[model samples]
Target chain A: MRRIMVCVKRVVDYNVRIRVKPDGTGVVLDGVKMSVNPFDEIALEEALRIKERGEADEVVAVSIGPDDAQQQLRTALAMGADRAILVKTTDVVEPLAAAQVFLTLVQKEQPQLVILGKQAIDDDAAQTGQMLAALWDRPQATFASKVELAGAAALVTREVDAGLETIEVDLPAVVTTDLRLNEPRYVKLPDIMKAKKKPLDVVELASTGVSAGETLKSVLVEPPKPRSKGVMVKDVAGLVDALKKKGLL
Target chain B: MATVLIVGEHDGSKLNPSTARCVTCAAQISGAEVHVALFGADLAAVAPQAAALKGVTKVLSVANPANAHPLAAVLAPQVVALAGPYTHVLGPSTTFGKDLMPRVAALLGVPQVSDAMSVDGPYKFKRPTYAGNAIVTVEAPESRKLVATVRTASFEAAPQGGQAAVEAVAVSVPLPTHTRFVSVSAANSDRPDLQTAAKVVSGGRALGSKENFQLIYSLADRMGAAVGASRAAVDAGYASNELQVGQTGKIIAPELYVAIGISGAIQHLTGIKDARTIVAINKDAEAPIFEIADYGLVGDLFQILPELEKSLA
Candidate 1:
């Protein structure tokens, strides 16, 4: 393989318990901690591993977001991506638009493989990779837990609802990473310094020949209803008695 | 009338219950004439089951040798070919639908509403984001065909009373051969499926090891409940990947959910928020699982497991 393009997105850190605004507009993002989407980090780690194993020559990290997303791309470079590309935009890029941008880049880079997260934590809309594959007219293996390249095809083990399902797709396919894929390696301090010197090219979203087609509009935003506090039972006998009382036994 | 075409999910033998739940969601749309599309090598047993769903009016059965497996690349084109007559295209928000619907949306040049939990109107839906921490009402354009994946957990399965007509349709789209199905290794169990189970028993990292995790299976079997695990237990190799119940794993809604030796993380809670009744048993009294549990017990699970099973017996 010549090159592998990995897609990364900036999202609220996983540990943060997000709170919706009182006005019911959107989540508060004033001073929250942000990092690379966990699934995307795993995808980048897989790409780097493929490159390190001599299967691919270069790994390019790409993202579409505001300028702050550069911080996440730099982290990708620090984690060993050969270079990074940031498609600059201030507007919200929905999954369809994001797929279009990736499609353009895929045609330009002609990478043998493209990897991305199954879903971004913020939107939880797991659509980009499959949509991109449709636009690119290529094969898509999503929710991949294990990927092995053999000859001109890749065997991917996906984490499906029933169990593990393995499929084979020809080269130049798109794979979306699942949680069990791999634990991402941490970016060390020296690698951070080296990453600062890596070539990161920034381009406008409009220049990619893709429009931010925002079709769905958010009419209202609200927090989830909290569960009511419960009672503590003294013993297993009491638990059984209580469950029977509630008709749950 | 708004024509809503639902993609039916099946495993060659029978239709998945998720398809019925999608039918329920589609019924919420005003004046929706629901039809199910089943793509498989043979629809002998599954087509009748799809037509039996309460609100389904017709079953579009596309039988082909290449439709043996649910490949997104192969199914998306066929779905687009059949989508011209319908106004809305819907599928369950399971792995099968999640993998295929977006590709259909892109091919149709329309945006998709993923995990639509509520149908506010024909083009408006309410969906959860941030792992169920936030809910947003989204409105799609009425000019284009609307494609969506229904959140099965949020809707009840439609009753089996309808006598919908079944139509065997042949699609003439060119299927791709670049993606091939190799094999699937599914966990064979007599226990009910965790996704559609009425009762669920979930273990956590506190279960200690693979051997100790058997306590959970024993309790679940005794209670006739499905078995699930927290991500920690799966990561520690105490449980298999498919048994994990969390935001990244399976989002399920059951009548009763019992959490034993599990400290509830928000991620895990996201999966069970819709469960009707929750019971928690943990040694630590401060475990977050107790907050949402309708009944909480603080004790050693080893001691409680045997007692609970004996009481059930």
Candidate 2:
């Protein structure tokens, strides 16, 4: 492969407990730390490894969001991406519009391989990669646990509902990562410094001619109702009693 | 009034329970004419089950040899072609449905409402974000067809009583060939599926190795519970990815969840928050798993596991 692209997203760190805003506008994100999505990190790590293995000439990291999302793209560069592109969008760019933007990039960049996280931890839509592949009429392998590149095809092992399924997609395919694909390498301070000088092109999302469809829109936001106060049983005996009393035993 | 198309998830022979759950989600739409679509090598044994779902108006079958496998590329266009006049198209939010429904939505040039948790009307809906921490209510435009994947966990299965009409439809959409099915190594199990199971017993990295995981299976077998594991255990090579119950893995809401030696990361807790009653057994007294647990036993799991098993037996 000559060039490979990795799609990343900036989202709430996996550790923080997300709370809803009192106004029901959205989640409280005033001060929450945002990082490269964990699954996206794995996807970028895979692309970097593919480049390091001399399988690709360069690895490009792409993200479509607000300007702050450029920070996530820079993190990808620190992790060894050759370059980055930020499709800056202030609007809540839904998956379809995001896919259209990526499609524009695909036509411009012409990367042989495109890899992305199976789903973003934020919206959890998990649709962009699949939608992109379909719009491009390219083969797609979603929830891939393992991906191995050969001469003209990629052997992808996917985590499906039934179990692990392995499929072979021809070159120029979209691969969405599942967890356990690989342990993303930690970026050192020196790499971060090096990434400061790397090329990161910011493109206006509106300039791409992609219109957000009328398919879906958010109207309200709320936190999941917390479970009732639960008792800590002294032993298994108490557990059984609790279950029996609830008619669940 | 909207005609909602419910895509049936099946392995050719039996319909996945999530399909019925998707029907339940569709039933929430006011004046919904729900239609269930079955596409496989043979729907002889599965069509009737779809027809029996309450609120369904019809069960459409597309029996094509190519559909022996649920390849998204092959199935997406077929669903799109049959989705004519449908104001809404829905599938269960499972591995199969997640893989299939989005492509169908895209092929129709419509933005898909994924993981929809509740329905207010034909276009307005609620869905979870940030891993179920926040539920966002959204509205799709009324001019075009809306497509969604129902969060099967949020609704119970539709009651089975309606005698929906069964019709075999002929589709001629040219299927994609670039994506081909090779072989699938399914984690064959006789116990109830982890997603649909009433009770689940999950182990953690403390299980040590793949062999020690047998204890989890033994206990789950005795309890007639499905087996699940933490991402750490799966990453440590102690279990398959299918059994990993976490934010990145399967999101399940079993009635009785027994977590053993799990440190209860927030990501892992996201998978089981909907569980009715949770029991945690761990050596660490302050493992986060205990925070939401209905019952906690702070002790050595090595000793407690055997004792608990013997008591249950």
Question: Which candidate's lDDT is highest?
Answer: 1
Pairs in clash, predicted candidate 2: A217-B138, A219-B137
The global C-alpha lDDT for each of the candidates, from Candidate 1 onward, is 0.95, 0.88
- Deviating ranges (above 4 Å) for candidate 1: none
Q: Which candidate achieves the best DockQ against the true structure?
A: 1
User: Can you give the DockQ of every candidate in the order shown?
Assistant: 0.90, 0.76
Prediction 2 global C-alpha lDDT: 0.88
Please give the distance, in angstroms, between residue B205's alpha carbon in candidate 1 and its true position after superposition: 0.7
TM-score of each: 0.99, 0.97
TM-score, structure 2 vs. true: 0.97
Q: Candidate 1: which pairs clash? A: none
